[model samples]
Each structure stands twice: as structure tokens, then as C-alpha cells.
Target: MSIEEKVTSIIVDQLGVEKDKVKPEASFVDDLGADSMDVVELVMAFEDNFSVQIPDQEENNIRTVQDAIDFIKENQKA
Candidate 1:
């Protein structure tokens, strides 16, 4: 499956959110209602699930779902 789908599933499972609500434009805070801790958990979940380490400097660059998708796609290729 694509990275977007995988990431979306993680967000849904972790945050108890409906699968349909994880659109690319949905903001983690304003749209998805994720708090700071949830955001942290989401990042960690992505890192763990993909077995890729997201550097602290790069983490800030992943503000949107598409950004995460791109990061995973580019980094997860061994």
C-alpha cells in the first residue's frame, strides 16, 4: 500500500478517529482535533511503523499529511 494509506491508518487507529476524516487537507489540530501529545504520538507511530528515524530537524517539516507521506516514501526506500 502507499505511504499515505499507511499513515492514515495509523492516525485513525491511534487517535480513535474515523477513517474518512484523515484527508490531506485535514489539519492535525484544527481539523482532526489532535492535541500536542497526540501529535507527538502520531510522529512516533510513523517512525516506528515505517522503521525510519525522522530527525528532529525534519520533523518540523512534516506539518501536513502529504509531507509525512513524502518523507516516508523517500526515506523508507532502502
Candidate 2:
């Protein structure tokens, strides 16, 4: 699967949300109903799946699904 597909899959699995709900513009907190802990777990999940370490500061900026997808595409190990 592509990076965008993988990121959307991760968010769907982690958040227990519908696949259609994993839109690029959807915000983890505001749109998807994720709490702070959920965000942390999601970050860990992303790191594990993509083999990339997202720093603490960068984590805060990843509010939307597109943000996570972009970060992974940019930083994931080949």
C-alpha cells in the first residue's frame, strides 16, 4: 500500500473509527474524538509501523491525518 493508505489504516485501527472517517483533513482530537493518550498511542503506533521516530515537538504539530501521512512519507526508513 501507499504511504497515505498505510497512514489511514493505522489511524483507523488505532482509533477504532470507520475507514471513511480517516480523511486527510480530519483532526485526531477535534474530528476523530481522540484524547491526549490516544494521540500518544497513535504516535507510538506510527513509529512502530513506519520505523521512524517522531520527536515530541513534531508530535504536537501532527493534528490532522494528512500531517501524519506527510511526516511518515518524509521521514520513514526505506
- In angstroms, the error of model 2 at 42 is 0.4
Q: Whole-model Cα lDDT per candidate?
A: 0.85, 0.94
lDDT of 1 by residue, 1-78 (tens): 777889999989888889998888777777788887888898999989999889988877877777788889889947
All candidates' TM-scores? 0.87, 0.96
Locate the minimum summed-lDDT window of 10 residues in model 1: 59-68
C-alpha RMSD for every candidate: 1.3, 0.7
Predicted structure 2, TM vs. truth: 0.96
Q: Model 1: runs farther than 4 Å from truth?
A: none
For candidate 2, write residues 1-57 as lDDT tens digits. Answer: 988888888888989999999989999999999999999999999999999999999
The regions of model 2 sitting more than 4 angstroms off are none
Model 2 worst lDDT run, 10 consecutive residues = 2-11
